[model samples]
Target: MTLYYAPRTVSAAVAIALNEVGAPYETVKIDFASSDQTKPGYHKVNPKGRVPALITDRGVLTETSALLDYVAALYPKARLVPDDPFQAAQMRSVMTYLASTWHINHAMGGRGARWAYQQSSFDDLKSKVTENITANCRYFEDEVVQGPFVLGNQFTLADAYFYTVTTWLPSDGVDIADFPHLHAYQQRMQARASVQKAQSDGFF
Candidate 1:
Protein backbone atom coordinates (compact mmCIF):
# COMPACT_ATOMS: atom_id res chain seq x y z
CA MET A 1 0.00 0.00 0.00
CA THR A 2 1.04 3.60 -0.55
CA LEU A 3 1.04 6.25 2.17
CA TYR A 4 -0.33 9.52 0.80
CA TYR A 5 0.18 12.77 2.71
CA ALA A 6 -2.15 15.39 1.28
CA PRO A 7 -3.60 18.52 2.84
CA ARG A 8 -7.12 18.34 1.54
CA THR A 9 -7.33 20.80 -1.41
CA VAL A 10 -4.18 21.13 -3.51
CA SER A 11 -3.64 17.41 -3.23
CA ALA A 12 -7.20 16.57 -4.18
CA ALA A 13 -6.33 16.28 -7.85
CA VAL A 14 -3.67 13.66 -7.29
CA ALA A 15 -5.88 11.74 -4.89
CA ILE A 16 -8.61 11.74 -7.49
CA ALA A 17 -6.22 10.54 -10.15
CA LEU A 18 -5.16 7.66 -7.92
CA ASN A 19 -8.78 6.79 -7.29
CA GLU A 20 -9.42 6.89 -11.03
CA VAL A 21 -6.93 4.05 -11.31
CA GLY A 22 -8.59 2.03 -8.53
CA ALA A 23 -5.30 1.55 -6.75
CA PRO A 24 -5.14 0.58 -3.12
CA TYR A 25 -3.58 3.25 -0.92
CA GLU A 26 -3.75 4.74 2.56
CA THR A 27 -4.20 8.49 2.98
CA VAL A 28 -2.92 10.71 5.78
CA LYS A 29 -4.09 14.32 5.79
CA ILE A 30 -1.57 17.07 6.48
CA ASP A 31 -2.99 20.20 7.98
CA PHE A 32 -1.25 23.05 6.19
CA ALA A 33 -3.05 25.63 8.30
CA SER A 34 -1.06 24.60 11.38
CA SER A 35 2.25 24.44 9.55
CA ASP A 36 2.27 20.67 9.68
CA GLN A 37 4.46 20.58 6.60
CA THR A 38 7.34 22.19 8.50
CA LYS A 39 7.04 19.94 11.51
CA PRO A 40 10.28 18.23 12.49
CA GLY A 41 9.51 14.62 11.56
CA TYR A 42 7.72 15.43 8.32
CA HIS A 43 10.88 16.58 6.54
CA LYS A 44 12.26 13.01 6.60
CA VAL A 45 9.23 11.94 4.56
CA ASN A 46 9.59 14.87 2.16
CA PRO A 47 12.59 17.14 2.67
CA LYS A 48 10.80 19.84 0.74
CA GLY A 49 8.01 19.63 3.35
CA ARG A 50 5.25 19.66 0.77
CA VAL A 51 1.85 18.09 0.75
CA PRO A 52 0.73 15.15 -1.44
CA ALA A 53 3.90 13.14 -1.04
CA LEU A 54 3.29 9.51 -1.90
CA ILE A 55 5.32 6.89 -0.05
CA THR A 56 5.01 3.94 -2.35
CA ASP A 57 6.64 0.51 -2.23
CA ARG A 58 9.44 1.92 -4.39
CA GLY A 59 10.04 5.18 -2.51
CA VAL A 60 8.70 8.59 -1.62
CA LEU A 61 7.32 10.46 -4.63
CA THR A 62 7.08 14.23 -4.54
CA GLU A 63 5.55 16.65 -7.02
CA THR A 64 2.00 16.07 -8.17
CA SER A 65 2.95 15.70 -11.83
CA ALA A 66 5.40 12.90 -11.07
CA LEU A 67 3.10 11.24 -8.58
CA LEU A 68 0.14 11.30 -10.95
CA ASP A 69 2.15 9.71 -13.74
CA TYR A 70 3.54 7.07 -11.42
CA VAL A 71 0.13 6.09 -10.07
CA ALA A 72 -1.49 6.09 -13.52
CA ALA A 73 1.17 3.79 -14.91
CA LEU A 74 0.56 1.35 -12.06
CA TYR A 75 -2.96 0.77 -13.39
CA PRO A 76 -2.85 0.55 -17.17
CA LYS A 77 -6.23 -1.12 -17.37
CA ALA A 78 -7.86 2.04 -15.99
CA ARG A 79 -6.79 4.06 -19.06
CA LEU A 80 -6.12 7.19 -17.00
CA VAL A 81 -3.31 7.84 -19.45
CA PRO A 82 -4.11 7.29 -23.11
CA ASP A 83 -2.56 4.45 -25.08
CA ASP A 84 -2.16 6.28 -28.39
CA PRO A 85 1.16 8.08 -28.68
CA PHE A 86 -0.30 11.36 -29.85
CA GLN A 87 -3.15 11.30 -27.37
CA ALA A 88 -0.69 10.45 -24.60
CA ALA A 89 1.47 13.38 -25.64
CA GLN A 90 -1.51 15.71 -25.59
CA MET A 91 -2.49 14.44 -22.16
CA ARG A 92 1.01 15.02 -20.86
CA SER A 93 1.10 18.50 -22.39
CA VAL A 94 -2.12 19.41 -20.67
CA MET A 95 -0.84 18.06 -17.37
CA THR A 96 2.44 19.94 -17.74
CA TYR A 97 0.57 23.13 -18.65
CA LEU A 98 -1.50 22.81 -15.51
CA ALA A 99 1.45 21.96 -13.26
CA SER A 100 4.01 24.46 -14.59
CA THR A 101 1.86 27.23 -16.01
CA TRP A 102 -1.36 27.59 -14.07
CA HIS A 103 0.03 26.28 -10.79
CA ILE A 104 2.97 28.68 -10.95
CA ASN A 105 0.63 31.54 -11.72
CA HIS A 106 -1.37 30.76 -8.60
CA ALA A 107 1.74 30.66 -6.44
CA MET A 108 2.94 34.01 -7.79
CA GLY A 109 -0.47 35.63 -7.70
CA GLY A 110 -1.01 34.60 -4.10
CA ARG A 111 2.38 36.01 -3.14
CA GLY A 112 1.68 39.23 -5.02
CA ALA A 113 -1.61 39.64 -3.26
CA ARG A 114 0.03 39.03 0.09
CA TRP A 115 2.67 41.61 -0.74
CA ALA A 116 0.04 44.10 -1.71
CA TYR A 117 -1.72 43.42 1.55
CA GLN A 118 1.54 44.34 3.27
CA GLN A 119 1.53 47.73 1.47
CA SER A 120 3.84 46.60 -1.28
CA SER A 121 3.27 47.80 -4.87
CA PHE A 122 2.32 44.47 -6.45
CA ASP A 123 -0.16 45.96 -8.88
CA ASP A 124 1.95 45.53 -12.00
CA LEU A 125 2.91 41.96 -11.15
CA LYS A 126 -0.60 41.00 -10.16
CA SER A 127 -1.99 42.48 -13.36
CA LYS A 128 0.43 40.42 -15.40
CA VAL A 129 -0.55 37.27 -13.54
CA THR A 130 -4.21 38.02 -14.12
CA GLU A 131 -3.56 38.52 -17.81
CA ASN A 132 -1.58 35.29 -18.11
CA ILE A 133 -4.23 33.34 -16.28
CA THR A 134 -6.95 34.83 -18.47
CA ALA A 135 -5.04 33.95 -21.61
CA ASN A 136 -4.69 30.32 -20.49
CA CYS A 137 -8.31 30.20 -19.47
CA ARG A 138 -9.32 31.51 -22.85
CA TYR A 139 -7.07 29.05 -24.60
CA PHE A 140 -8.53 26.15 -22.67
CA GLU A 141 -12.00 27.52 -23.16
CA ASP A 142 -11.54 27.60 -26.91
CA GLU A 143 -9.49 24.45 -27.22
CA VAL A 144 -11.40 21.99 -25.05
CA VAL A 145 -13.76 19.86 -27.12
CA GLN A 146 -17.40 19.45 -26.17
CA GLY A 147 -16.53 15.90 -25.11
CA PRO A 148 -16.77 14.85 -21.46
CA PHE A 149 -13.06 15.18 -20.63
CA VAL A 150 -9.94 17.26 -21.21
CA LEU A 151 -8.51 14.84 -23.77
CA GLY A 152 -11.69 14.28 -25.70
CA ASN A 153 -14.18 11.78 -24.21
CA GLN A 154 -11.64 9.87 -22.13
CA PHE A 155 -11.08 10.79 -18.48
CA THR A 156 -7.37 11.35 -18.04
CA LEU A 157 -5.25 12.83 -15.23
CA ALA A 158 -5.18 16.13 -17.08
CA ASP A 159 -8.84 16.75 -16.38
CA ALA A 160 -8.34 16.03 -12.69
CA TYR A 161 -5.44 18.48 -12.37
CA PHE A 162 -7.24 21.11 -14.45
CA TYR A 163 -10.35 20.90 -12.31
CA THR A 164 -8.33 21.30 -9.13
CA VAL A 165 -6.47 24.42 -10.29
CA THR A 166 -9.24 26.10 -12.29
CA THR A 167 -11.39 26.19 -9.17
CA TRP A 168 -8.91 28.66 -7.70
CA LEU A 169 -9.72 31.29 -10.35
CA PRO A 170 -12.36 33.15 -8.37
CA SER A 171 -10.16 33.50 -5.30
CA ASP A 172 -7.37 34.80 -7.52
CA GLY A 173 -9.82 37.33 -8.97
CA VAL A 174 -10.06 35.59 -12.31
CA ASP A 175 -13.52 35.78 -13.85
CA ILE A 176 -13.88 32.52 -15.76
CA ALA A 177 -17.41 33.40 -16.84
CA ASP A 178 -15.99 34.46 -20.18
CA PHE A 179 -14.45 31.03 -20.63
CA PRO A 180 -17.63 29.10 -21.08
CA HIS A 181 -16.04 25.93 -22.33
CA LEU A 182 -13.60 25.74 -19.47
CA HIS A 183 -16.36 26.50 -17.00
CA ALA A 184 -18.47 23.73 -18.46
CA TYR A 185 -15.51 21.42 -18.35
CA GLN A 186 -14.99 22.20 -14.68
CA GLN A 187 -18.61 21.37 -13.92
CA ARG A 188 -18.45 18.16 -15.86
CA MET A 189 -15.22 17.05 -14.19
CA GLN A 190 -16.48 17.65 -10.69
CA ALA A 191 -19.34 15.29 -11.44
CA ARG A 192 -17.16 12.31 -12.29
CA ALA A 193 -17.41 9.18 -10.10
CA SER A 194 -13.70 9.13 -9.40
CA VAL A 195 -13.71 12.84 -8.59
CA GLN A 196 -16.68 12.47 -6.30
CA LYS A 197 -15.10 9.47 -4.57
CA ALA A 198 -11.84 11.33 -4.16
CA GLN A 199 -13.66 14.22 -2.57
CA SER A 200 -15.63 11.93 -0.27
CA ASP A 201 -12.44 10.20 0.80
CA GLY A 202 -10.92 13.63 1.62
CA PHE A 203 -7.98 13.19 -0.74
CA PHE A 204 -7.21 16.89 -0.87
Candidate 2:
Protein backbone atom coordinates (compact mmCIF):
# COMPACT_ATOMS: atom_id res chain seq x y z
CA MET A 1 0.00 0.00 0.00
CA THR A 2 1.07 3.57 -0.68
CA LEU A 3 -0.37 6.43 1.40
CA TYR A 4 -0.41 10.00 0.14
CA TYR A 5 -0.29 12.47 3.04
CA ALA A 6 0.65 15.92 4.24
CA PRO A 7 2.34 16.60 7.52
CA ARG A 8 0.45 18.10 10.48
CA THR A 9 -2.84 17.80 8.63
CA VAL A 10 -5.86 15.56 9.14
CA SER A 11 -4.00 13.16 6.87
CA ALA A 12 -1.96 12.24 9.93
CA ALA A 13 -5.04 10.44 11.24
CA VAL A 14 -4.67 7.95 8.42
CA ALA A 15 -0.97 7.58 9.23
CA ILE A 16 -1.77 6.86 12.86
CA ALA A 17 -4.20 4.15 11.82
CA LEU A 18 -1.63 2.74 9.41
CA ASN A 19 0.90 2.68 12.23
CA GLU A 20 -1.54 0.77 14.41
CA VAL A 21 -1.99 -1.83 11.72
CA GLY A 22 1.80 -2.37 11.47
CA ALA A 23 1.53 -2.65 7.73
CA PRO A 24 4.25 -2.39 5.12
CA TYR A 25 3.69 0.67 2.97
CA GLU A 26 5.27 3.74 1.44
CA THR A 27 4.33 7.38 1.87
CA VAL A 28 4.10 9.83 -1.01
CA LYS A 29 4.30 13.26 0.54
CA ILE A 30 1.88 15.80 -0.91
CA ASP A 31 3.76 19.00 -0.22
CA PHE A 32 1.11 21.62 0.28
CA ALA A 33 3.81 24.23 0.89
CA SER A 34 4.66 24.02 -2.80
CA SER A 35 1.09 23.41 -4.00
CA ASP A 36 2.08 19.89 -5.00
CA GLN A 37 -1.32 18.53 -4.10
CA THR A 38 -3.01 20.84 -6.61
CA LYS A 39 -0.90 19.62 -9.46
CA PRO A 40 -2.28 17.35 -12.17
CA GLY A 41 0.07 14.50 -11.17
CA TYR A 42 -1.58 14.21 -7.76
CA HIS A 43 -5.04 14.66 -9.25
CA LYS A 44 -4.54 11.27 -10.87
CA VAL A 45 -4.09 9.69 -7.44
CA ASN A 46 -7.00 11.59 -5.94
CA PRO A 47 -9.18 13.47 -8.38
CA LYS A 48 -10.21 15.73 -5.55
CA GLY A 49 -6.53 16.72 -5.10
CA ARG A 50 -6.67 15.84 -1.44
CA VAL A 51 -4.23 14.05 0.83
CA PRO A 52 -4.93 10.75 2.63
CA ALA A 53 -5.29 8.87 -0.63
CA LEU A 54 -4.33 5.22 -0.24
CA ILE A 55 -3.26 2.84 -2.99
CA THR A 56 -4.69 -0.51 -2.04
CA ASP A 57 -4.73 -3.93 -3.67
CA ARG A 58 -8.16 -3.20 -5.09
CA GLY A 59 -7.77 0.45 -6.05
CA VAL A 60 -7.08 3.97 -4.84
CA LEU A 61 -9.09 4.96 -1.78
CA THR A 62 -9.54 8.61 -0.83
CA GLU A 63 -11.09 10.44 2.16
CA THR A 64 -9.87 10.13 5.73
CA SER A 65 -12.83 8.14 7.11
CA ALA A 66 -12.84 5.67 4.23
CA LEU A 67 -9.10 5.11 4.44
CA LEU A 68 -9.28 4.58 8.19
CA ASP A 69 -12.18 2.15 7.81
CA TYR A 70 -10.39 0.28 5.05
CA VAL A 71 -7.24 -0.12 7.16
CA ALA A 72 -9.27 -1.40 10.11
CA ALA A 73 -11.12 -3.85 7.89
CA LEU A 74 -7.96 -5.11 6.25
CA TYR A 75 -6.40 -5.85 9.62
CA PRO A 76 -9.26 -6.91 11.87
CA LYS A 77 -6.86 -8.41 14.39
CA ALA A 78 -5.50 -4.94 15.07
CA ARG A 79 -8.90 -4.19 16.63
CA LEU A 80 -8.87 -0.59 15.47
CA VAL A 81 -12.67 -0.62 15.27
CA PRO A 82 -15.17 -1.96 17.78
CA ASP A 83 -16.88 -5.31 17.29
CA ASP A 84 -20.21 -4.46 18.95
CA PRO A 85 -22.74 -2.94 16.56
CA PHE A 86 -23.95 -0.12 18.81
CA GLN A 87 -20.44 0.80 19.88
CA ALA A 88 -19.39 0.85 16.26
CA ALA A 89 -22.29 3.15 15.44
CA GLN A 90 -21.30 5.49 18.24
CA MET A 91 -17.78 5.52 16.87
CA ARG A 92 -19.11 6.48 13.46
CA SER A 93 -21.19 9.26 15.03
CA VAL A 94 -18.13 10.78 16.66
CA MET A 95 -16.12 10.55 13.43
CA THR A 96 -18.98 12.10 11.47
CA TYR A 97 -19.23 14.98 13.92
CA LEU A 98 -15.51 15.62 13.75
CA ALA A 99 -15.52 15.56 9.96
CA SER A 100 -18.74 17.48 9.40
CA THR A 101 -18.72 19.94 12.29
CA TRP A 102 -15.39 20.22 14.07
CA HIS A 103 -13.22 20.09 10.97
CA ILE A 104 -15.43 22.53 9.06
CA ASN A 105 -15.27 24.97 11.93
CA HIS A 106 -11.46 24.81 11.90
CA ALA A 107 -11.37 25.18 8.14
CA MET A 108 -13.43 28.32 8.32
CA GLY A 109 -10.46 30.11 9.82
CA GLY A 110 -8.61 29.93 6.52
CA ARG A 111 -10.58 28.01 3.90
CA GLY A 112 -13.89 29.85 3.77
CA ALA A 113 -13.83 29.93 -0.04
CA ARG A 114 -15.47 26.55 0.23
CA TRP A 115 -18.68 28.38 1.16
CA ALA A 116 -18.44 31.97 -0.11
CA TYR A 117 -15.98 33.73 -2.37
CA GLN A 118 -16.17 37.17 -0.79
CA GLN A 119 -13.19 38.32 1.29
CA SER A 120 -15.59 39.79 3.85
CA SER A 121 -17.19 36.38 4.31
CA PHE A 122 -13.78 34.81 4.83
CA ASP A 123 -12.90 37.40 7.45
CA ASP A 124 -16.20 36.79 9.20
CA LEU A 125 -15.49 33.10 9.38
CA LYS A 126 -11.94 33.64 10.62
CA SER A 127 -13.21 35.75 13.51
CA LYS A 128 -15.54 33.06 14.82
CA VAL A 129 -13.71 29.86 13.90
CA THR A 130 -12.08 29.46 17.29
CA GLU A 131 -15.33 29.98 19.15
CA ASN A 132 -17.14 27.53 16.90
CA ILE A 133 -14.49 24.86 17.45
CA THR A 134 -14.51 25.38 21.19
CA ALA A 135 -18.30 25.14 21.45
CA ASN A 136 -18.40 21.89 19.48
CA CYS A 137 -15.48 20.60 21.57
CA ARG A 138 -17.48 21.29 24.71
CA TYR A 139 -20.18 19.00 23.34
CA PHE A 140 -17.66 16.23 22.66
CA GLU A 141 -15.76 16.66 25.93
CA ASP A 142 -18.98 16.46 27.94
CA GLU A 143 -21.53 14.53 25.92
CA VAL A 144 -19.16 12.08 24.31
CA VAL A 145 -16.06 10.40 25.85
CA GLN A 146 -17.94 8.11 28.24
CA GLY A 147 -14.75 6.49 29.52
CA PRO A 148 -11.01 6.28 28.94
CA PHE A 149 -11.78 6.02 25.24
CA VAL A 150 -14.81 7.01 23.19
CA LEU A 151 -16.10 3.45 23.60
CA GLY A 152 -15.46 3.13 27.33
CA ASN A 153 -12.15 1.38 28.11
CA GLN A 154 -11.86 -0.04 24.64
CA PHE A 155 -9.88 1.95 22.05
CA THR A 156 -11.79 2.36 18.83
CA LEU A 157 -11.05 3.88 15.45
CA ALA A 158 -12.76 7.03 16.68
CA ASP A 159 -9.83 7.71 19.02
CA ALA A 160 -7.44 8.10 16.11
CA TYR A 161 -9.92 10.24 14.19
CA PHE A 162 -10.69 12.52 17.13
CA TYR A 163 -7.05 12.77 18.20
CA THR A 164 -6.06 14.02 14.78
CA VAL A 165 -8.66 16.76 14.94
CA THR A 166 -7.43 17.77 18.36
CA THR A 167 -3.98 18.40 16.84
CA TRP A 168 -5.36 21.42 15.02
CA LEU A 169 -6.68 23.11 18.18
CA PRO A 170 -3.59 24.99 19.23
CA SER A 171 -2.99 26.26 15.69
CA ASP A 172 -6.68 27.09 15.36
CA GLY A 173 -6.24 29.62 18.24
CA VAL A 174 -7.68 27.26 20.83
CA ASP A 175 -6.11 27.12 24.26
CA ILE A 176 -6.63 23.49 25.13
CA ALA A 177 -6.19 24.31 28.80
CA ASP A 178 -9.81 25.47 28.67
CA PHE A 179 -10.84 21.90 27.87
CA PRO A 180 -9.21 19.80 30.60
CA HIS A 181 -10.77 16.50 29.64
CA LEU A 182 -9.93 17.11 26.03
CA HIS A 183 -6.39 18.09 26.95
CA ALA A 184 -5.93 14.92 28.95
CA TYR A 185 -7.40 12.99 26.04
CA GLN A 186 -4.71 14.49 23.83
CA GLN A 187 -2.05 13.41 26.26
CA ARG A 188 -3.38 9.87 26.33
CA MET A 189 -3.38 9.69 22.57
CA GLN A 190 0.14 11.07 22.35
CA ALA A 191 1.35 8.34 24.69
CA ARG A 192 0.15 5.59 22.38
CA ALA A 193 2.81 3.69 20.44
CA SER A 194 1.07 4.30 17.19
CA VAL A 195 0.97 8.06 17.72
CA GLN A 196 4.59 8.01 18.78
CA LYS A 197 5.49 6.17 15.61
CA ALA A 198 3.56 8.61 13.49
CA GLN A 199 5.48 11.44 15.14
CA SER A 200 8.83 9.75 14.47
CA ASP A 201 7.79 9.15 10.88
CA GLY A 202 7.21 12.92 10.53
CA PHE A 203 3.46 12.57 10.06
CA PHE A 204 2.90 14.97 13.03
Candidate 3:
Protein backbone atom coordinates (compact mmCIF):
# COMPACT_ATOMS: atom_id res chain seq x y z
CA MET A 1 0.00 0.00 0.00
CA THR A 2 1.02 3.60 -0.54
CA LEU A 3 -0.07 7.11 0.31
CA TYR A 4 -0.28 9.70 -2.45
CA TYR A 5 -0.15 13.41 -1.68
CA ALA A 6 -1.71 15.22 -4.59
CA PRO A 7 -3.01 18.57 -5.79
CA ARG A 8 -5.87 19.41 -8.14
CA THR A 9 -4.19 19.26 -11.52
CA VAL A 10 -1.84 16.60 -12.89
CA SER A 11 -2.35 14.48 -9.83
CA ALA A 12 -5.79 13.65 -11.14
CA ALA A 13 -4.33 11.38 -13.77
CA VAL A 14 -2.05 9.57 -11.36
CA ALA A 15 -4.92 9.01 -8.95
CA ILE A 16 -7.17 7.71 -11.68
CA ALA A 17 -4.57 5.36 -13.08
CA LEU A 18 -3.86 3.95 -9.65
CA ASN A 19 -7.56 3.43 -9.10
CA GLU A 20 -7.84 1.65 -12.45
CA VAL A 21 -5.35 -0.90 -11.19
CA GLY A 22 -7.27 -1.39 -7.94
CA ALA A 23 -4.11 -0.48 -6.07
CA PRO A 24 -4.60 -0.01 -2.36
CA TYR A 25 -3.67 3.51 -1.43
CA GLU A 26 -4.62 6.58 0.59
CA THR A 27 -4.46 10.23 -0.45
CA VAL A 28 -3.24 13.37 1.27
CA LYS A 29 -4.65 16.43 -0.45
CA ILE A 30 -2.35 19.44 -0.30
CA ASP A 31 -3.70 22.96 -0.59
CA PHE A 32 -1.42 24.87 -2.89
CA ALA A 33 -3.09 28.09 -1.72
CA SER A 34 -1.40 28.13 1.69
CA SER A 35 1.20 25.38 1.86
CA ASP A 36 4.79 25.83 0.83
CA GLN A 37 6.01 22.61 -0.71
CA THR A 38 9.64 23.49 -0.04
CA LYS A 39 8.92 23.98 3.66
CA PRO A 40 10.48 21.57 6.18
CA GLY A 41 7.47 19.32 6.85
CA TYR A 42 6.37 18.77 3.24
CA HIS A 43 9.96 18.75 2.07
CA LYS A 44 10.64 15.83 4.38
CA VAL A 45 8.23 13.75 2.28
CA ASN A 46 9.31 15.22 -1.04
CA PRO A 47 11.87 17.98 -1.08
CA LYS A 48 10.11 19.27 -4.21
CA GLY A 49 6.62 19.40 -2.61
CA ARG A 50 5.04 18.61 -5.93
CA VAL A 51 1.74 16.84 -5.92
CA PRO A 52 1.40 13.18 -6.83
CA ALA A 53 4.19 12.18 -4.45
CA LEU A 54 4.06 8.48 -3.73
CA ILE A 55 4.93 7.25 -0.24
CA THR A 56 5.69 3.56 -0.54
CA ASP A 57 7.46 0.92 1.52
CA ARG A 58 10.68 1.89 -0.23
CA GLY A 59 10.40 5.68 0.07
CA VAL A 60 8.68 8.75 -1.30
CA LEU A 61 9.00 9.28 -5.04
CA THR A 62 8.26 12.63 -6.65
CA GLU A 63 7.63 13.85 -10.20
CA THR A 64 4.53 12.80 -12.11
CA SER A 65 6.49 10.97 -14.78
CA ALA A 66 8.44 8.89 -12.29
CA LEU A 67 5.36 8.28 -10.15
CA LEU A 68 3.29 7.03 -13.08
CA ASP A 69 6.06 4.75 -14.25
CA TYR A 70 6.44 3.37 -10.72
CA VAL A 71 2.72 2.69 -10.53
CA ALA A 72 2.79 0.64 -13.73
CA ALA A 73 5.78 -1.31 -12.48
CA LEU A 74 4.24 -1.88 -9.08
CA TYR A 75 1.13 -3.35 -10.64
CA PRO A 76 2.19 -5.23 -13.71
CA LYS A 77 -1.04 -7.17 -13.91
CA ALA A 78 -2.82 -3.89 -14.69
CA ARG A 79 -0.97 -3.78 -18.03
CA LEU A 80 -0.61 -0.02 -17.70
CA VAL A 81 2.87 -0.03 -19.22
CA PRO A 82 4.22 -1.66 -22.29
CA ASP A 83 6.55 -4.69 -22.17
CA ASP A 84 8.29 -4.19 -25.50
CA PRO A 85 11.28 -1.86 -25.81
CA PHE A 86 9.87 0.24 -28.63
CA GLN A 87 6.41 0.41 -27.15
CA ALA A 88 7.86 1.42 -23.83
CA ALA A 89 9.83 4.17 -25.52
CA GLN A 90 6.67 5.47 -27.14
CA MET A 91 4.87 5.43 -23.82
CA ARG A 92 7.62 7.42 -22.17
CA SER A 93 7.68 9.78 -25.10
CA VAL A 94 4.00 10.66 -24.63
CA MET A 95 4.40 11.25 -20.92
CA THR A 96 7.50 13.36 -21.48
CA TYR A 97 5.71 15.51 -24.00
CA LEU A 98 2.84 16.11 -21.60
CA ALA A 99 5.06 16.96 -18.65
CA SER A 100 7.63 19.14 -20.42
CA THR A 101 5.34 20.92 -22.85
CA TRP A 102 1.90 21.23 -21.32
CA HIS A 103 2.04 21.34 -17.51
CA ILE A 104 4.77 23.96 -17.07
CA ASN A 105 3.66 26.18 -19.90
CA HIS A 106 -0.02 26.57 -18.99
CA ALA A 107 -0.41 26.02 -15.28
CA MET A 108 -0.78 28.44 -12.31
CA GLY A 109 -2.69 31.17 -14.10
CA GLY A 110 0.35 31.63 -16.34
CA ARG A 111 2.41 32.69 -13.36
CA GLY A 112 4.58 29.77 -12.37
CA ALA A 113 8.32 29.00 -12.24
CA ARG A 114 8.33 27.13 -15.52
CA TRP A 115 8.87 30.25 -17.60
CA ALA A 116 9.05 33.97 -16.91
CA TYR A 117 5.46 34.74 -15.85
CA GLN A 118 5.56 38.51 -16.14
CA GLN A 119 3.67 40.32 -18.88
CA SER A 120 6.80 40.93 -20.93
CA SER A 121 7.59 37.25 -21.30
CA PHE A 122 4.11 35.81 -20.76
CA ASP A 123 2.96 36.11 -24.36
CA ASP A 124 6.14 34.65 -25.73
CA LEU A 125 6.16 31.79 -23.27
CA LYS A 126 2.50 31.12 -23.93
CA SER A 127 3.08 31.06 -27.67
CA LYS A 128 5.91 28.62 -27.27
CA VAL A 129 3.86 26.41 -24.98
CA THR A 130 0.91 26.43 -27.36
CA GLU A 131 3.09 25.65 -30.36
CA ASN A 132 4.90 22.85 -28.61
CA ILE A 133 1.73 21.25 -27.22
CA THR A 134 -0.11 21.60 -30.51
CA ALA A 135 2.76 19.96 -32.31
CA ASN A 136 2.84 17.21 -29.74
CA CYS A 137 -0.91 16.76 -30.08
CA ARG A 138 -0.50 16.50 -33.83
CA TYR A 139 2.18 13.90 -33.40
CA PHE A 140 -0.19 11.94 -31.23
CA GLU A 141 -3.01 12.34 -33.71
CA ASP A 142 -0.80 11.15 -36.54
CA GLU A 143 1.15 8.27 -35.00
CA VAL A 144 1.47 7.92 -31.24
CA VAL A 145 -1.93 6.37 -30.70
CA GLN A 146 -4.01 3.72 -32.38
CA GLY A 147 -7.70 3.68 -31.53
CA PRO A 148 -8.26 5.23 -28.08
CA PHE A 149 -5.09 4.45 -26.15
CA VAL A 150 -1.61 5.80 -26.75
CA LEU A 151 -0.20 2.25 -26.70
CA GLY A 152 -2.44 0.93 -29.42
CA ASN A 153 -5.60 -0.73 -28.09
CA GLN A 154 -3.95 -1.48 -24.78
CA PHE A 155 -4.60 1.15 -22.11
CA THR A 156 -1.22 2.18 -20.71
CA LEU A 157 0.13 4.85 -18.37
CA ALA A 158 0.43 7.08 -21.43
CA ASP A 159 -3.34 7.42 -21.45
CA ALA A 160 -3.29 8.72 -17.91
CA TYR A 161 -0.77 11.40 -18.89
CA PHE A 162 -2.82 12.28 -21.91
CA TYR A 163 -6.03 12.62 -19.96
CA THR A 164 -4.40 14.83 -17.37
CA VAL A 165 -2.79 17.32 -19.73
CA THR A 166 -5.72 17.48 -22.09
CA THR A 167 -7.96 18.51 -19.22
CA TRP A 168 -6.08 21.80 -18.95
CA LEU A 169 -6.85 23.04 -22.44
CA PRO A 170 -10.18 24.62 -21.56
CA SER A 171 -8.61 26.84 -18.93
CA ASP A 172 -5.46 27.50 -20.93
CA GLY A 173 -7.59 28.58 -23.91
CA VAL A 174 -6.18 25.90 -26.15
CA ASP A 175 -8.63 24.54 -28.68
CA ILE A 176 -8.77 20.76 -28.93
CA ALA A 177 -11.60 20.46 -31.41
CA ASP A 178 -9.11 20.82 -34.24
CA PHE A 179 -7.48 17.61 -33.12
CA PRO A 180 -10.40 15.27 -33.63
CA HIS A 181 -8.66 12.05 -32.71
CA LEU A 182 -7.14 13.50 -29.59
CA HIS A 183 -10.49 14.97 -28.57
CA ALA A 184 -12.16 11.61 -29.16
CA TYR A 185 -9.47 9.90 -27.17
CA GLN A 186 -10.09 12.15 -24.21
CA GLN A 187 -13.77 11.42 -24.38
CA ARG A 188 -13.08 7.71 -24.46
CA MET A 189 -10.87 7.89 -21.37
CA GLN A 190 -13.39 10.01 -19.45
CA ALA A 191 -16.04 7.43 -20.18
CA ARG A 192 -14.19 4.67 -18.32
CA ALA A 193 -15.78 3.44 -15.07
CA SER A 194 -12.51 3.66 -13.17
CA VAL A 195 -12.00 7.20 -14.42
CA GLN A 196 -15.55 8.06 -13.36
CA LYS A 197 -14.88 6.71 -9.89
CA ALA A 198 -11.63 8.61 -9.60
CA GLN A 199 -13.42 11.77 -10.67
CA SER A 200 -16.08 11.19 -8.03
CA ASP A 201 -13.39 10.74 -5.40
CA GLY A 202 -12.16 14.31 -6.08
CA PHE A 203 -9.87 14.24 -9.11
CA PHE A 204 -11.67 16.99 -11.08
Find the candidate with the highest TM-score and give its number: 2
Clashing pairs for model 3 are none
Q: Please list all clashing residue pairs in model 2, or write none if there are none.
A: none
TM-score each candidate: 0.86, 0.96, 0.86
How much is 153 displaced in model 3, in angstroms?
0.9
lDDT for each residue of candidate 3 in 84-171, tens digit (9 for 90 to 100): 8888898898788778766765663465445564676666666566666677677778977787687878888888878877887777
Q: After superposition, how far is residue 17 of candidate 2 from its true place, in Å?
A: 0.9
Q: Enumerate residue pairs that collide in model 1.
A: 8-204
* TM-score attained by model 1: 0.86
For lDDT, the strongest prediction is 2
**Model 2 residue 7 lDDT score:** 93
Better of 1 and 2 by TM-score: 2
lDDT of 2 by residue, 1-204 (tens): 998999988888888888888988899888988989889999999989878899998999988899899999999999988888988888999998888888888989878988898999999999998788889888978899776777789887888888888888887888888988888888898999999998988888
The local distance difference test score of model 1 is 0.76
Which is the winner by lDDT between candidate 2 and candidate 3? 2
